[model samples]
Target chain A: MKTRLTGRVWKYGDDVNTDVIFPGKYTYSIADPREMALHALEDLDPGFVAAVRPGDIIVAGKNWGCGSSREQAVVCLKEAGVGAIVARSFARIYFRNAINQALPIVTCDAVDGVENGDEITIDFAAGTVKTPRRVFTFPPLPAEVLEIIEDGGLIPHVRKQLGR
Target chain B: MGKTFAEKVLAQKAGLQQITAGQIVTVKPDRLLTHDNTSAIAATFRKIGVARVADPSMNVIVLDHVTPAANETYAISHQATRAFVAEQEIAAFYDIGEGICHQVLPEKGHAWPGAVIVGSDSHTPTAGAFGAFAAGIGRTEAAAVMATGEIWLRVPESIRVQLHGTLPARVSAKDVSLYLIGLLRADGADYCSVEFAGEAINAMSVGERMTLTNMSAEMGAKNAVVEPDEKTLAWLAGRVTQPFAPVYADADATYASVIEMDTTTLAPQVACPHTVDNVAPITEVAGKRVDQVLIGTCTNGRLEDLRAAAEILRGKHIARSVRLLILPASREILQAALAEGIITDLIAAGATLLNPGCGPCLGAHQGCLAPGEAVLSTSNRNFKGRMGSKDAAIYLGSPATAAATALTGVITDPREV
Candidate 1:
């Protein structure tokens, strides 16, 4: 996993559920990650995909990814080249899915003052996120969780163990 | 400290003598439930390079969401699910018209006490009604479960909710749940397990208790459970033939928090448009015009819920401007309603009876809301675009309230009607 990251921020409010993140209507019809990326945040922010650049960061309020356990939600963001998600909190299943997919998600209170398009820097090991005006800190990821991300997600990690 | 219900269940499943909140352990679920999501899960399962399912008998797939092939996409998805079931030789598959996965599982004796169940859908936690430890997982994790029969989980801290006093005549368990959601806020129980207790819970029937557990997802609960007792066993006597391991928390179980609610004065509640936690008392929002009324879902689609709606619609006429739709949760409940004349009464009152499935709830098909419309429904969610149109609005209410809204063509209080 990348230890240092910088990106322009895209902000959203609380309770950004899975349905809006990646609507259920396309879950079965669309299988490719990049195709699903086109619809990412379409429901909540219609211009999201158009505005999003690769390696951009999403700064959101609490309870991000609150509804439905669709891995597609995480896949969409990863495919769009989102560097990391910084939110005050996240729904549990989404949090686990992000780690398993090697998407960097940080929890921090600095999400409050972060503006859209603000340049931000994140240090995963140091548990610190630096915005234009302030710095926010979160607890470092558990070693086990970091190991999985470092090995390029759980699937690759397991594959390496089996030497496949 | 003594263990909560969640702690005890995880410890037992992990084969550990003791555990605490936040402890991570691997568990082999007794059952893995799936609905429309099974189509996507099948794709992921194949990607894992598993030639055969780890345990075909343990996987239960139900065709509920967008059932009967609402469109070409859904039809193809259903075909994939049927093929997967046939290939895996899964015995517990439910076809279209059978019912919603959550309701059918319990009706068919699959969910039981002391078992750990995971599903690919969010409301899988509904199985906690039978005192089981159940939670929702994503497709990849579900595929891992199918491939290895094992998955990892972190034990969640428990919030003990004590429901006291009697509900008013016009109010029911749906009102109780909506009120609780308002009090707990949307993410109040995030990543935590909730256990319902107290005299009010003791007095509720098993069907009624399910509402409490079913809506726990609205509060972001990992799972919700009601401890099994006589009512639970009585409800299971004929339905569940296999013996089940019944586990309960110790008498002195410690909880992260305890909330004691008095329902005696609780009014019928409704979660307003755009969010489940944006709840308001019925009196405040009454007379707001509605375009539709839906009286079923996993949350409030049981027999008792139908009865509640039927009582209000009996011999009464629905507003001509309103499109009233009633869907029973399962075939068994639908049949029971028909036998009791609830179905006839609802139709006589100008309601349209849709098939027993979840198409309309999640905006897949059936009774979809047009843009700028408002609907009062018994379903769990009211998120934007939840019922097909982002510009439309959805209000979550009890069946009684839904019936009343159908009659008035507005969000009216059942008590006032």
Candidate 2:
């Protein structure tokens, strides 16, 4: 697992719920992550699907992923090749689901200074993100949480621990 | 030192001598709930290369989200679930038209005091009303639990919500929940366990308490619990056969914060469009024209909720310009309403009754809104595009408020009626 990532930014406001991340109506019909990727953020920004480049990161305000506990919301972002998500705060379930899916997310209050399309590099292990102009620091993840991320998620981590 | 209800429950489940906030621990819950998306979970479980569920009897599956096959895809999903249930020999399985999972699980004795329950749906905390530790997990987590019978959790700090004073006539559990949501600010209690106490909460019926726990997720609570007492025991008398002891917070239990709410002065409240935290008193948003009124969900679909609506709509018809849709939370509740004539009273008052399931609530199907319409709902959540169209607006209120709005074709205050 890579601890360093560089990507373009896609900025979003507060309370970006699961409904906009991946619509509820599509819950049943979609299963493939690539198929789910096509509709990611479709409701909030219709052009997001087309404009999003691989390795683009999402920078959001407080309470990002604040609706249903749908893992598809995290899956879609990972499938769409989102490098990482940086938000001021996160709804608890989304934060956990992202960890389960091995999606990198950082909480930084300075997200407001990062503009859309700004090229940024993040050293997750160092808890620092740098833009062309400045650097922002977030608390490093707990050692156990980092272990799960390094193993590519809980499923794999459990497998390794169980020696299965 | 005293332990909070969540701390006590997690400690027992984790087989630890003691546990505190922020410590990560693994627990095998007494029950795991998956509804509507059981097929997806089954697929995930198989993909994980697990031979079989760790304990089939510990898992309960329900078909309520899009029952009666809204489309071929849903029908196929249901078929897959049936096959999976048969293959796994799952102990409890509720088919279509049975009822919503949150309602049926407790009705069938899956919830009890001091029990730890996790479900795939966000509203799983509804069972916490029984003094149990219940929370929601995502599909992959559910699948992982199915395989190993255990999941990890970071112990949450507890918040004490003391309810004092009596509720006004027009005010119901729905109002209390919305009022709390306003104070919690959507993320005020995020990642924390909420413990309900005081006179008002003790005086509330089991159904009312369920409403409170169900909406705890709206404020991002990890779980919501009410300590079981004589009232709780009485409600669980015949409904639950399992033997369990109640867990209570110690007097000296450390708490993150304490919030006190007096219900006597509380009036009917509504959560305005786009966000649940966007709430205001009924009087402030009254007179906004409504195109539809929906009364039911896992949140407010119990028998007491339907009876409240029937009382308000007894002889009066809904406004000609307004559409009213009623859904009972469970099949048993629907049958009880039919016997009590609550269903007839609602229909006679011009309300359309839909099958017992979660269709319109999640914008899946059944009474979807047209663009630019406004609706008053008794269900939880009013996010933009929640009920089909982003252009439409949503107002969440009590069943009484929904009934009043149905009759007047506007966001009329229940008290005014």
Give the distance in Å from residue A133's predicted Cα in candidate 2 to where it truly belongs. Answer: 4.4
Candidate 1 residue lDDT tens string, B1-417: 678889999999999999999878889999999887788888877766767888997899999988788778778889999999999999999999999999999888888899899998889888998999999888777877888788888899899999999888989888899898898888899999999999989988898899988899989999999999998888878887788889888778888789999999999999998888889999999989999999998888889999999999999999999999998899999999999999999999999999999858988789888998999999998888878888999999999999999998989999987
How well does candidate 1 score on lDDT at residue A153? Answer: 78
- Write down the DockQ of candidate 2: 0.69
Q: For all the candidates, what are their Cα RMSDs to the real structure?
A: 1.4, 1.1
Q: Candidate 1 docking category?
A: medium
Q: Which residue window of length 10 is worst by lDDT in model 2 chain B? A: B43-52
Interface RMSD of each: 1.7, 1.2
Pairing residues by index, what is the TM-score of model 2? 0.98
What local lDDT does model 2 show for residue B74?
A: 89
Per-model TM-score of chain B:
0.99, 0.99
